[model samples]
Target: MMCGALYFTPIGRRDSCTPSEFARFENDEQKGSKGGRIHKNKKYGFKFVLLETRKGYSIIVGTWSGIAYQGENHERIESGPMITIRHPLWTKSDPRQDIPIMILTRAQAEIANDLSVSAAPFGPQEFSRNAKFVFALPPRFDYGDSTGTEEVREILRNHPLHPF
Candidate 1:
């Protein structure tokens, strides 16, 4: 169980994450919520990608910049990327008890290693074991602003995990 910086987002659906929804998680990197409280991991300066195992997609949370809610007043606070990864646990409604996974680039893996988060380079076998599909965006691409799901699908259609 490695434990370094990771970006996180929520999964509201059953088996997939929309490009737009993923964009928000990818671009938005802040430490707490609207309720205002410091997350234990905030100090670690990590960002995490949130996903559902059922959705069959995994993302690597890289560097991010944005405002986040923190403290008792729910004040808007801006901060650099903080790092962390929550352990995989199935969503309540999903009876399979599947935990979501993350895929990292070489640099991201290094960062995760620094923070003690378990991470490995993106590979087909890793993808096969962790997800049915992958966003697989390179570090240079700003996936948060990407709205073209069809274009992405076209590119990834040949991938073994793609359902289509």
Candidate 2:
């Protein structure tokens, strides 16, 4: 299995969000737990999405508040997940885990690990979790007169790819 890192808006602090926003990821886990869980483990609580999948699937929510312009460090992590993904726009249903899956390669995972977003949604609550799509692009071109990988990065920096 492979893990992929994804980016969204930079998350602030947990206290900044209203109860409703936090419920997306929080309440579910809390209810599932045995105790009347109220608090969440800070480590598991992130403003970003992270997951690794070969066959099955799971949702990934990230909580990062940083800036990476030019799509250099598009995502911040070691390895991204190896799952199929789909973006919110592709499927017009409420954004949830039900979205399609995405297939991510090592290079693509690295790119996702190096992404940065403008601002995180569901503010005051660390970060909001969203459904992402598995992104796939056309075949690579071997044009005689064209920029290489770096230029390609610029071209598809804002790819609508996510893991399942």
Candidate 3:
């Protein structure tokens, strides 16, 4: 259970990340698990590409991000995640039941460690068992502004200036 720093961006249908960023991210993704080209270890689960600082573009893609309030017919069918993985960035705002699988870069994890929160760092042991390793943005990103912040807070809570 390597307590590492990880970065995550919801891969929306329209990825906001740039091509260079995307290419770099894609290369990293394959390193983790063989999503397409070649099959790596099942336990690796994207671990190979994700060990260091990684950038990812993902969409919650559950169709829920754009979902509006609906009737009973729209209820999600799944009872729960088939499994759980750990994320280093998650804090008290995050669930304890989930596993923080991704091994983040030292620079990335440093920011999380400084959040004035009582933190936990998982060791490398948990990697194979957990399944995913994410890289958090490096520190120096600022969270200082308070304008229109509520909207961002509803989800990311990332300060527009969050020095990443």
Output the number of the lDDT-best candidate. 1
lDDT of 3 by residue, 40-85 (tens): 2233343222222222422121110111113444422211111112
TM-score of the candidate numbered 3? 0.20
Candidate number that wins on TM-score, 1 or 3: 1
Name the better of 1 and 2 by lDDT: 1
What TM-score against the true fold does each predicted structure earn? 0.24, 0.19, 0.20
Clashes of 2: 42
Best by TM-score: 1
Report the C-alpha lDDT of model 2 over 79-150, residue by residue, as the tens digit.
222221222222223322222122334444344443432232211111123233223221222123332334
Model 3 residue runs over 4 Å out of place are: 1-130, 135-142, 146-148, 157-164
lDDT of each: 0.29, 0.28, 0.26
What's model 2's overall lDDT? 0.28
Measured by TM-score, how close is model 1 to the native structure?
A: 0.24
RMSD in angstroms between candidate 1 and the native structure over all alpha carbons: 17.6
> What lDDT score is found at residue 108 in candidate 2?
42
